[model samples]
Structures are given as C-alpha cells and as structure tokens.
Target chain A: MNAIDHPLVTAYLDAVARETAELPAERRAELLADLREHVEASDARDDDQVREVLTGLGEPRTVAASALSEETPAGHIHPAPVAPGRAKLTVILLGCSGPLLLASSVVGTIALIAGLALLWGAPRWETRHKVIGTATAVAVPVLVFVGALLGAASRIGPIELLLLLAFSLGVPAVGATVLLRAVRR
Target chain B: MNEAGGRVPSQLRKGLLEYCVLALLRDEPKYGVELVAELSAVSVMTTSQGTIYPLLSRLRREGLVDTELRDSPSGPPRRYYTLTAVGLASLTEFARAWPLFRDAVDHFLTDPQGDPA
Candidate 1:
C-alpha cells in the first residue's frame, strides 16, 4: 500500500464505500474523493495521531448515514431507518382498494385516497413507484365510474363485472408488490 | 452505537452548521483538512468531522462556494474552497438574523416558567 493508505484508514473508507452503495454513483465518487483527500492531508506522524484523525472522522456507518441524508431532497426530512410497517400498511391499503370498491364505493375511495397519501409521503419508494402505484390502484374506480357514466357497464353481466374487478385488483396488487420490494429498509 | 443502530449525534442547529461552514470560507480559501480541523476544534458543534464533507459538497453544488486545485508544498495537491458572491450575501444575511434568533431562544430558555401569560 502507498504511505498515505494507512491500514486503519483503508478499512474505514472501505466500510464507508460499502454503506454508501445506494447513493447515486456520481455522489458516491465525490464523497469518497473528498474523504480520501482529507485522509491524505492529515499526514499523521505516528500511529497515535492517525488514531486521533480516524476517531475525529467517526464510524463509517455514521459517515454514510449523514451522507445519505444530505442527498435526500430538501422537503423529505427523512427520519431514521425506513419503516417496514408503513410499507406494509401502504400495500394493504392500495392493493385492497379494488376489492373493497366492489363491496362499497365510498369505503373503497377512502382507502385508495388514504393509500395514495401514504404512498406519496413515504420515502421508501421512488417517485416512479408511487406514480405506478397510484395509477394502478385508481384504475379500477376510474374505469368503473367512467364505464357507468358511458353505459358501458350496462351491457356487462355480473360475472364479467366481477372479473373486471379482479383484473383491477391484480394490477394494483402488482404495483403494491413492487413498492414493498423497493422499500429502502 | 448506544442502541445498536441508533444515531445519537448531537443536533446542533442544522442550518447553523452549514452557515458556520460557509462563514469559515469568507475571509480566505481553505482546504478540506483545514476546514474540518476548524470545526472539530469547537466542542459545541460536537460531531464526527467527516460528516462535514457532504455539507461541503453541497455548498459547492449550490453555488455558495467554488474550489480550486492547487499544488501543496508538501504532498498531494489540495483543493481550496473559496466563498463566492452568493456565499458572502448568504453569510451576511444569516449574521443579521442570528442575533435576533439567538435572543429569542435565550429568552425562552431563561424565562420558561415566568412568561405563561
């Protein structure tokens, strides 16, 4: 190893790189570069000074966490670890809206809207997932409302309608699955 | 570390931390090690000095600061960060507001029970 590549410093930096795998590649590179510059500049005369420099740098995980939070957009103000509970609740609410709409439109609308609110608010999933989730979850109600207004549903049998509801449920179900899988936790 | 994965770093006024960083560059350009050292010297800021890199990176991205790579007399070339026109304006604005903001916080802290009216 080069003289500046102190064993302890290398280990710390390696850990930080591993923890920051989720950061945008450009950001991760910039961060690592900045850290490397600092380590090189410290130029500790001995192991003890090296230790003090590393201690001042703190744990790798903390450095990664702080780095991650800084990248989160201005309004996000994310709390600590992502909540699995929130992700689960969001899935259930959005995924069930189609089935519930068949039983009661008012209840179904409430669930879909609430689910959408949570979906948009949660940071676990990206904006793309949120848009897809919203689209799929709302598709059933929208189709139903539009079909009714246009008299398209008048020609369909009960079994066909049930199939339509199931189809609607299926799309949002897939959407919810994608979101659950995407949870940053 | 106290609670397995808990982050227990002291919460200094978050905005103040970045502004303090910007303030450091107002007079003259400073390198990464120099800036980090200045912050670490203050116990009240109380954080792992490494975390300040992200803030520095952000300050650069936001056009508040600009960096120049210069050859150091010692080892590797050092990246020196200098405040920009925008940065100076922002620091001045914060300096103006901070006294009032500080006094308000002090007032509440000192007179917690006396001003229930």
Candidate 2:
C-alpha cells in the first residue's frame, strides 16, 4: 500500500528508465534509486497525494532529458563516447573470436576472456559497448558448445549448422563493428 | 490527474542549479528527499525534483561533494551529502560572480532601448 507501489508511480519510473537507457549505468541507477527514495519519503497516503507527488516529479521523459543534457556540454547527447577507440586489441579479439572459438582451443578461451577484460576496462567504450562486446564474445562459445553437443547427438541438421556458422561469424562481426563505430564516434 | 501546468522548467536556471545545490549544502548536509523539498519550494527553480540527483551525482563524481550514511531519527539511514572543500571553493566563486552577472542581465532587461551607459 506504499505510495511508490502505486501503478502510476511505477509507470512514471518505468518511463524514466526507458528514456534514460543511454545513460551510464551507475548514473542511471542512482537517478532512479534517488527518485524511488523520494517517492517513498513523500508520505502520500492516498491516490490524490500520490498523483500530486508524481505531478511534481514532471514527465519522465523530461527528467531523462535533463539528466542526459547535464552530461553534455552543448546540450547535444551522443549515445557513445566522442573519443577514438583505443581498444583495438579488444576489438580484434572479439572480431576474430568466432573462428578461434569454433576449434574449441584453449587459446580461443584465453583470447575471449582477454577481449572481455579489455572491453570492460577500456574507458572510451561505454557500458553498452562493453555489454554488446561481452554478449557477442560469450555467445560464440555458447553457440558452438551447444552446436557441438547437438551435432554429437545428431539432433542438429546441416541447415542449422550452416546457420550457426553464419551467426557465429556474423554476430561477432556486427558486435565488433558496432563497438568500433561507437568509440570512433 | 497529471497536470501539464504543474511545473515550469526554468531553462535559464540550468547552469546555476548546481551552485544552488552547493549553497543548499553550505550549512549542513541533507538527505535526498530533504534536498528535493527545499529545491521545489522555489517556483522558478522547480522542475522534476528528481532531476537534482543527477546533478548531485555529477558533483560527487567531480570531487565537489561527498556523501555519508547517517542514521536518521526515523525510518532509515539517509545518505547525507556534504560539501567538500572544492565545492565550497566553487560556490564561493559563483557567489562572487553572480551579482555582476545579475547586474549585467538586469541592465539589459531594464534598458532594452540600445542604451550604452
């Protein structure tokens, strides 16, 4: 029965989260957490008071806009950093990981881990980039491993294998390319 | 009932709001809700009171402020934001410069007839 648990309040917060999807994770989380605490502390005992509290918070999109605008100098926001990508090695590891991982080699595993470590550590790349890089990097092995198990049990077909191969190559390629362009932006 | 006229965002206040926050913390630290309440009290400076947190976050990131968990008299421990030395310095600088800036702005507002004195 807490005011914050009201549907309207939840919707407003959800909208804020959706609109601020581009912010750095910690900043976005802190904003939402603060807002949650704000709502909780408002002591809105009824629907009318809850509505008033939400009204005082303004539209979620506006709040998100204000938060994003604060991050930039010219009021123009970029989804990625403006600095050139210095994580070339990370890109290389991710980009080439598909073929490396197909062999199930220990070196491939090492390279994948290194690529992810570097991707996360690279300050120029935003968290989204790191996430994409990580997901794509990890996906290669997972897909291949599943494909290998299925291939052994003879449950997978040639078409599926071919498609897997294509994804194994294409997904990481696209992920790595997106990361390159992101940092280059 | 969401009313569109409920709040007005003062765009001109964007750059100065952080200084206002610094001023708010000048005397003592404040929890999140308390800060929001004080800020929204000003009609011109009001917007989504929640937006202040991001500004506060940036201030902390920039080493202008620091936070600590303090036990409150009621509900739960609140995170109290305290102004750092750097924050005080920046606030002092802003205080020193605001009057000159305000006078310049006021002169233009009061004398918009191309007066050059």
For model 2 chain B, the run of ten residues with the poorest summed lDDT: B1-10
| Model 2 DockQ (Cα-based) | 0.59
| True lDDT of residue A146, candidate 1 | 83
Alpha carbon lDDT at A79, candidate 1: 52
Q: Could you give candidate 2's per-residue lDDT for residues A1-185 as a string of tens digits?
A: 98888998899889999999988888888889888878888889888999999888878987898888777758554445433434678888888888787766787888888888778876677788788888887887887676677765377679877887798788889899998887766
Clashes within 3 Å, all models in order? 0, 0
Over the stretch A29-129, how does candidate 1's per-residue lDDT look in tens digits?
A: 98888888787777776778878888878789988988988888479655544467887888999999988987898999899999999999876677888
Clashing pairs in 2: none
**lDDT by residue for model 1 over B2-78, one digit each (tens)?**
42123333454355788888899988999988998898787656367788998888788889999999999987788
Residue ranges of candidate 1 with Cα displaced over 4 Å: A1-3, A76-185, B1-9, B113-117
- TM per candidate, chain B: 0.85, 0.86
Task: Give the residue spans of candidate 2 off by over 4 A.
Answer: A75-185, B1-9, B112-117
Model 1: clashing residue pairs? none
